[model samples]
Target: MQSWLDMLREARAQGRRFARVRVVTLPLNDYSRFGVWCSQFTNGAGEDIRYLERGKAAALALPDHDYWLFDSRKLVRMHFDDRDAFLGGEVIEDAAEIVKHNYWRDAAWHHAIRRDDLATEQHLGRV
Candidate 1:
């Protein structure tokens, strides 16, 4: 986590934009709670992180897949194993697919709550 934060810090220092939106289910699990705890530092390093409840995201018809969209031009769709372990990703260069990912990213970002706010709510047992 510190390694990623270091990279993010450097990227922000270089004027690069960094953001993440995590879709979490209600009754947060241990892993999810840990992530929220770590976000305190990452968010402080200039990474704009947000959270959206799974139910809310489902109502919006968002896919349950995760991917990284680079510069609005490239995408690498993530593939996970049955146990939700990271396997690998397929780099997608198709214009249509890239457009879809960009659109989703924009929509999710628009609706997701900031990490700081979510963390506070979670810590207070209101999430």
Candidate 2:
């Protein structure tokens, strides 16, 4: 955890920006709650983390998968196993796909709440 925070801090110190839009369910599960706890450190390190409730995102027809978009051009779409374990990601640079991902990012960002605000509003705490 310290190492991870160090990396984020270093990246921010070097002028690299970070953003994440997490789709979460109401009454968050243990993992989701833990992620909220972790976000505190990362957010302080300059990561612009936000949360979009699953139902709200579904209403907007947002894609279900998580991804990392870089420079509004390159995207690293994450893949997960049935048990929700990380299964690595596929890098995509196709113009059309990048546009699609950026579209979702824009929509999500427009509606999502910042992590701390969501945590407070939802009364989130360690599970």
Candidate 3:
């Protein structure tokens, strides 16, 4: 747990100095399996993530604020404490790649659209 906190502190420092902070939103349910959350952010070489684990949860940020949640339906997304900060971040215009999706069929995890950042909680359909 201490190491996880350290990584987050480092990520925050990086966020401030290099803008590595990526904020996203996801639908979360307490009853759902936690492994789904762990696999998302854990893609990077780190201990907080489970890498390929299928049904676990990972605390992306400290204080259990935001998370990467996965549902039994194979839907996964990152969650941010503040939707405004996330949607309006520089990742939209700067990141080399970006992905976005809605609970829709045609989209199916649409990727390569930097403009996807514009879709915030306000734009999201009813949960």
Q: Which one is best on TM-score?
A: 1
Show pairs that collide, candidate 1: none
Say what the RMSD of model 2 is. 1.8
Candidate maximizing lDDT:
2
lDDT of 3 by residue, 1-127 (tens): 4575556567655652111122233442332224333333432323232111112112311222222222212233334445435532122221222222212211222221121222232243212
For every model shown, what is its TM-score relative to the native structure? 0.92, 0.91, 0.19
Model 2, backbone clash pairs (residues 3+ apart or across chains), number: 0
Off by over 4 Å in 1: 124-127
Q: How many residue pairs clash in each candidate?
A: 0, 0, 6
Candidate 2 Cα errors over 4 Å, as ranges: 125-127
For all predictions, the C-alpha RMSD in Å is 2.3, 1.8, 17.2
For candidate 1, write residues 1-127 as lDDT tens digits: 7898899999999999988899998678989998887777888888888999999888888889999988889899999999999999999989998999888888888889987788777773322
Overall lDDT per candidate, in order of appearance: 0.86, 0.90, 0.28
Candidate 2 per-residue lDDT over residues 1-127, each given as its tens digit: 7887788899999998888899999989988888898898888877889999999999999998989898889999999999999999999979999999999999999999999898898797433
Give the Cα error of residue 20 in candidate 2, in Å. Answer: 0.6
Model 3 misplacement above 4 A: 16-98, 102-127
Model 2 lDDT-worst window of ten: 118-127
